[model samples]
Every structure is written in structure tokens, then in C-alpha cells.
Target: MGRKVALGGILTAISIIFLYLAVYLPSAKLTMYFLTGIIPGFILVEMGARQAWLLYFATSMLSFLVLGNLVNAVPYIFIFGIYPLIKYYIEKTRNILIELTLKLLFFNIASLAVYFIWTRVFLINITIAFPIVWLVLGLQFAFLVYDYVFTRVIFYYWDKIRVYWRKDVR
Candidate 1:
């Protein structure tokens, strides 16, 4: 209990610091920086540990939009959805590193479609670099390294992640 709280506090502080620096860097918006600040702790909390929902809600309140703007739910979906889906797909199958790679490749295609639709529906200005930038951003946000890193990491814990889907356990 104490350790998780301490870790969460430390992570929150670190996130605030990172958010400050990123905000001042004159690239992404301050809200975007806040979103980055929030993600790591969000991941930690959602691991079925600690005050996950509390931390998530607090982070959302801090990062909330006051004036009307299109929500950047993309970041959240990338973290929770794509990352989990990729992991789940990889963990469920054996000797299928190549297959996992193909799935993620196709996942990127779907993500790009979502990006296009989101921009077309909400964002007034869609830059030419949006797709390219989002793709790179997706790779980072998805927490996926190259095919090599994935093969190595997944091989190590294939059984562990796979347990979540097992009827015997869940």
C-alpha cells in the first residue's frame, strides 16, 4: 500500500516536471504536455494496482478542457486500446512473431483511418504532416519497438500476459 502510494506520488511529480519542460519547449501545446505527463502514471495505475481510477480522474480534471475544443481521445485510445490489443494478440499466439508484426502493421492502417476521420470531423486544419507525424507518434505511444525488440520481449513473458485471457483464470 505505502509503496504504491509513494511510487504514484513520485511518478506524478515526475510527470508534472516533464509536462512543464515539454510545455515550455514551444512544440506541442501545454495540454498535449499534460497528456504526456498523465500517460505513464495511467499505465502504472491500470496494471490492476493502486488507485487507478482516482489517479485517472484527477489527471483528467487537471487536463480538462474549459473552452470548447475537440477532445484528444486519440492519446488515451492509443495507450489503452492499441497497446493492449497488440499485446493481447501477440501473447495469445505462439511462434507467431511474424504474425504479430503483420497485425500491428494493419493496426496502423486502421489508426490512420481513425486519424483521418477524427481530423475531418473535428479539427479544422489538418496538416500535411499529420499522418506522418501521427504514425511516428503512434509507434511511440503504442510502446512498440521494432520487430526485433518485440520478438525478444514477447518471448520472455508470453505465458504471463496470455493468462489474462484464459478461462481457467479469468
Candidate 2:
């Protein structure tokens, strides 16, 4: 219990740091957010869904407070932060078609929510130089790639990093 709490706190702090980076490094905002998103998966794997969800809430609230901008926290809140849990449950079904369908559906819905919030609520005028459909398609493709990379990272951590930690402790 002590270790779980400590691990959760450490991951939460790391996530806040990533969120801070997103605020200062505009060019790497998405990358930083992506990296932050990866932490929840680690939490979920090491602890459990409950701890991971707690981490998500802690990180989300801290990010908004720390960044002082709701817009900056949008990606983490709307998409990346909660995605690992979503992925875990969806993939547990073990049906590729269902998993793919649900994952893509979640991505599309989350993307739309983010877009609507960014443009409508925030009143940020983003003039896309291309058709909106093209942008959506590109984002869909990018999401698939992101999902693949996310899974690979989880597997790598479980297979390699976690093993090393266990061995060192022994």
C-alpha cells in the first residue's frame, strides 16, 4: 500500500512536469502530452485501474491549476489522460474488430470534443489550410499510429523495465 501510494505520487508529479513543458514548449506540446499519457498505462500495469484513475484525476486537476490555462490541458484531459484505461477495457474483449472499432470511435469522439471545445468554447480561430475532411482523415491515421506506439511502450515496460526493477529489489 505504501509503495502503491508512493508510485502514484511520483507518476502524478512526472505528469505535471510534462504538462508544464507543454505550456512552455508549444512545438512539443503534443509530444509532451503523449509522454504524459504514457504514465497512466504504467500506473495501470503496476498498480491497477483504481490507482490509474486516481492518478488521472490528480494529474488533470493539477495540470489545470499549474498551467493556469484550460486550453493547454485540453489534450491531456479530453484524450490522452483517460485513454489507457479505455484501451485496457476495450482490448480485454480480445476481439480485434471490436477493439479497433471501439478505439477508433473513442478517438473520433474525443477529437471532435477537443475540436469543439478549442474552437467554440475557447474561441480560438484555427484556419486550416486544407479541407476539414482531410484533416480528420489525417488525424485518424495519426491516432492509429499513436495507439500502436502506446501498446508497444506498455509491452516494453512490462517485459523489460519491470523485470529489471524486480531483479534489483531481489
Candidate 3:
């Protein structure tokens, strides 16, 4: 129990640092934000969905406070941080069609929410020229690639380091 708490705390700190880096370093915002997503994946793999969610809530709330701009953290909190658990359940379903369908549905909903926040709340002139359909399709493709990469990363960690780490996780 103590070990889980310590690990969760550590991952939460790392996630917060990533959020801060994204907020402070404009040049590296994309990279830092994407990197932040990986922390939740690690937690999901190491602890479980419940612990991963705890970390997600902690990171998301802390990110909003640190960012001082809800728009900036919406992508992380809604899409990135939660992807791993979604992936876990999708994979467990063992139905490629259902997995693909659910994955696309989730991505579309999240993408629309992000889009709505950016355009409506932040008033970022993004969809002025580009059609909303195009934007959503692009996001869907990107999410597909992201999902593939996430699976590959999980495989790599599972074979290389997860065994050793799990020994101390409980």
C-alpha cells in the first residue's frame, strides 16, 4: 500500500512537472504535453485503472491550477491522460471491430470537446478556414497512430522493464 502511494506520488509529481514545462516552454509544449500522457500509461500498467484514474484526477486538477488556463490542459486531461485505460479495456474486449469502433468514438468525442473548448472558450481562430469534418478526420487519423504507438510502447516496457518493476509495486 505504501509502495503504491509512493509510486503514485512520484508519477503525479512527474506529470505536474510535465504540465509546468508545457505551460512555461512554448517551444516544447507539444513534446512536453505528449510526454505527460505517458505517465498515466505507466500508472495504468503498473498499478491498475483505479490507481491510474487517481493519478489522472490529481494531474488534471493540478494542471488546471498550474496552467491557469483550462484550455491548455483540456487536451491532456480529457484525451491523453485517459487513453491508456481506454486502450486497456478495448484490448480486453478482444474484438477488433468493436475496439476500432469504440476507439474512434471516444477520439471523436474528445476531439470535438477539445475543438469546442478551443474555438468557443479560448476563441482561437482555428476552424475558420478548415472544415470541422476535416479537423475531426485528421484527429481520428492522429489518434489511430497514437494508439498504435501506445501499444508498441507497452510491449516494449512489458518485456524489458515491467517484470522487474512489478516486483516492487505491491
Candidate 4:
């Protein structure tokens, strides 16, 4: 539908802008990546899984081309960018324990992959002040918080913002 296509285009553009900002603002790179991740959820809710996937691929490719530095898009491409879609499917099982386990499993695996790619492939040196175990634990905790916040934002959009937009579109 025209509405879906328009919204998808808008969200994709917004995501690219965030990715662009992430390149310029080193301190806010993570935040920008997180925001870019959130945009796909809107497409998922408004359009569907297929549309969301399209948006993800479009944004990923555009970010890579526009940024011209794989390092800037690494976190988004590896983890944050695709997380919303992954989360949606994972949560559909409707079992809290299974969902939590699978989500954490995905996070850990993706994170390790990202670390491997970042350090080994990119040759970036990440100097951690503490032990690797502590870093892993901290990352797990942060992931839990991110998941909770992501759910809340989705619910809020569904309950409040989506209502207005749905009416307009109809």
C-alpha cells in the first residue's frame, strides 16, 4: 500500500541519518545505532516481517555506502540493526523462559561474532579495564535492559501513536 511504502521509506531515511550521525559523534554512536534499530520495529508493526526485512537490508546497504567506513556501521550491522526483527520472532513463542533464553543466546552469539570481526578482521584494539568475564556479564545485563526498553517502546507506539496513524491511513 502507499501508506506502508511511504512510512517504510521515511523510517529507512531516518535510520540512515542516525547512522550518519553515529559516524560524526563517536560518543553517541551506540545510541544512534540503538535508535536505528528501533526504526525497523515500526515497519514490522505497521507493515509486516517482509517489509521490515526489506527496510533492514536497505538501511544496512545505505549505511555501508554512505558511511564509507565499516567500523562506524559495525555495531548496527552485527547486532542492533537486525535485533528488532529477531526479537519479534523470538518473542512469538509466547514462553517467557524460552524467549529469554533464546534472546540471551542470540545476544551472546552475535556479540562474540561482532567482537571477533571487530578485533580480528578490522584489527581494532579494544582495551578493556577488567576481565573478559566481567565484560560479558555487564553486556548481558545491558542487553536485558535494552530488551525491556524495546518492548515498552513498542507497546507505547501500539497503544498511542499507532492508533492515530491507523485512523488517518484508513
Candidate 5:
């Protein structure tokens, strides 16, 4: 329990740092935002869903307050931050097709929800800048890339990194 708390604290600190960097570095904002999910991914793999949730929410609230941007934190907190934990359960079915399908479904819905909230509620007219189809296609491709990268990272962490980390922690 102490180890879990310590690890969760580390993950939360890393996530918050990434989010703060996202706010300061406008050009690298997207990359920083995406990277914020990585530590939570590690927590999800090493600990469990409950601890991952704790770390995620801690980062979300800190990002919201420190960064002062609910928009920035929404997608991460609602979807990307917790994806690895969700994927752990999804992959238990032992069917690649089911796993991919569910992952895509979650990605698409979360993407659309963020888009809806931004465009409709906030009235951020993106139509004048980019067509809707183009945006959707971009998000589709982005999710594909994210899914691929996530799988590789998870594999590496579980098979290679976990062994070392577990020894030290134990």
C-alpha cells in the first residue's frame, strides 16, 4: 500500500508537470498533453484500475486549477489518461478484433464528445478553418497511431521494465 501510494504520487507529479508544460509551450502543447497520459498508463499496468483512477483524477484537478483550462484536461482525464487500465480488461477476452473494436469505439466517442463540447458549447468555429470530414479523418488516423504506440509501450513496460521495477519495489 505504501509503495502504491508513492508510485501514484510520482505519476501524478509527472502528469501535472507535462500539463503545465503544455500550457507554457504552445507549439508542443499537443505532444505534452499526449505524454501526460504515459505515467498514468504505467500506474495502470503496475498497480490497478483504482490506483490509476486516483492518479488520473489528481492530475486532472491539478491541471484544471494550475493550467486554468478545462478544455485541455477534458480529453485526457475522460479518455486518454485511463485508456491503459481500460485496455487491460478489454484485452482479457483474448480476441484481437474485439479489443481493437472496443478501443476504436472508445476513441471515436471521446473524440466526438470533445469536438461537440468545443464547437457547440464553446462556439469555437472550426468549420471556417477545417472541414468536418477532414477533422474526423485526422482524429481517426491519430487514434490509430496512438493505439499502435500504446501497444508497443505497454508491451515493453510489462515485459522489460516491470521486472526491474518490481524487484526494487519488493
Candidate 6:
């Protein structure tokens, strides 16, 4: 338990630092922008999807008061239109990659579309909205990559933890 707490703190530090790197990304390379913001999201999903969403909401509430940024509602945790599609594929006994791919697709394609439409209708200046949208999307995608990689590796250990045993210590 202590080790997990320490690890969580370390990951949060790394994520905050990477999010700080958002300034380095150029307009044309919006993907990088999304990747940085998603670092924390990735860590959240790794711990627990539902709990991750709660953590995301907490961070988002803070972000709003600090920066007045409303992009936090992009629904990164729940993944719009993705769960159903992935479920369809899973029912067919498809590979895990397919599910991850759908997660990416939902965030990159559907959620972004929703965000863009919302920002366009509400925000007066679409120009200012573009960069923010790009960054949010970039973060979502990056988190997906990290989540997929970490999730697979964690599963490996989780599987082993059940069977591994210590010997000669009696």
C-alpha cells in the first residue's frame, strides 16, 4: 500500500511536468498538444477507470477556477460512442487492440467533434478555441496510448501476482 502511494505521487509529478510542456507544441502539430494533457488521464485510467474519472473531474474543477478553461468536459474518462462500439466487437471475441483502438477513435473522432461543435456555438472567437481544442484532443490521445501500454503491462503482473509464491522462508 505504501509503495502504491509513492508510485502515484511520482506519476502525478511527471504528469504535471509534461502538461507544462504544452507550450512547446506548434499549431500544425496539434497531436503533441493532446498527448501532454493526457498524461494524467492515462495515469488515472491505469489506477481505475471510474476513480480516474473522479480524479479528472477534481482536476478539471481546479482548472476552471484557475484558468477558466471549459475544455475539461470533453468526457475523456467515459469515452463517447466508444464503449458501445467496443462492446460490439468484444461480443464477437475480437482482440483487445480493437477495444483500445475504439477508445482512441471515440476520443479523437467523436468527442472532439462534440467539443468543437460546443465551443463554436458558445465561444465568440473560434480562433482562440482552436488551440484549446487541439490541446485537449492531443491530451486525450496521449493518455490513450499510455493507458493501453500501462494497462497491458499491469495485466501481466496482475496475472502473475496470483500464481507467484515465496519459498524457503518458512
**Model-by-model lDDT, in order?**
0.48, 0.93, 0.84, 0.90, 0.79, 0.46
From the highest TM-score down, the ranking of the candidates is 2, 4, 3, 5, 1, 6
What lDDT tens digits, residue by residue, belong to model 6 across residues 16-78?
333333334335223433443344444443454543444444444443354333343233223
Ranking by lDDT: 2, 4, 3, 5, 1, 6
TM-score (all chains, Cα) for each model: 0.42, 0.95, 0.88, 0.95, 0.86, 0.40
Model 5 accuracy (lDDT, Cα): 0.79
> Which tens-of-lDDT digit does each residue in 16-97 have in candidate 1?
4444444455476544444453444344323442354444444444433321232443333333223433444565666577
Query: Which lDDT tens digits does candidate 5 get at residues 1-170?
Result: 89888888887888888887877788998788678877777887788788878887788778778776667777677677777767778889999899878888888887778778888877777654778788777878888798788789878998888988577654
Error of 6 at 81 (Å): 16
Compute the lDDT of residue 60 as modeled in candidate 3: 88
Q: In candidate 6, list every pair of residues with a backbone clash.
A: 34-138, 34-139, 35-138, 38-139
| Candidate 2: stretches off by over 4 Å | 167-170
Candidate 2 structure quality by residue, lDDT tens digits, 24-134 = 899999899899999999999887999999999999999878886779899899899999999999999999999999999999999889989999999999799989999
Off by over 4 Å in 3: 128-133, 166-170
Q: Which residue pairs collide, candidate 2?
A: none
Best by lDDT: 2
In candidate 3, what residue range of length 10 has the lowest lDDT sum?
161-170
With candidate 6 superimposed using the best TM-score fit, by how many Å does residue 4's alpha carbon deviate from the native? 1.9
How far residue 61's Cα lies from its native spot in candidate 1, in Å, is 5.0
Candidate 3 per-residue lDDT over residues 1-170, each given as its tens digit = 99889999999999988888887788998778778888888888788899998999999888877776667788897788888878788889899999999999988888788888888888988735778778767878988888888788788887788887575543
Task: Give me the displacement of residue 108 in model 5, in angstroms.
Answer: 1.3
Which candidate would rank higher by lDDT, 1 or 2? Answer: 2
RMSD of 6: 8.4
**What does candidate 6 score on TM?**
0.40
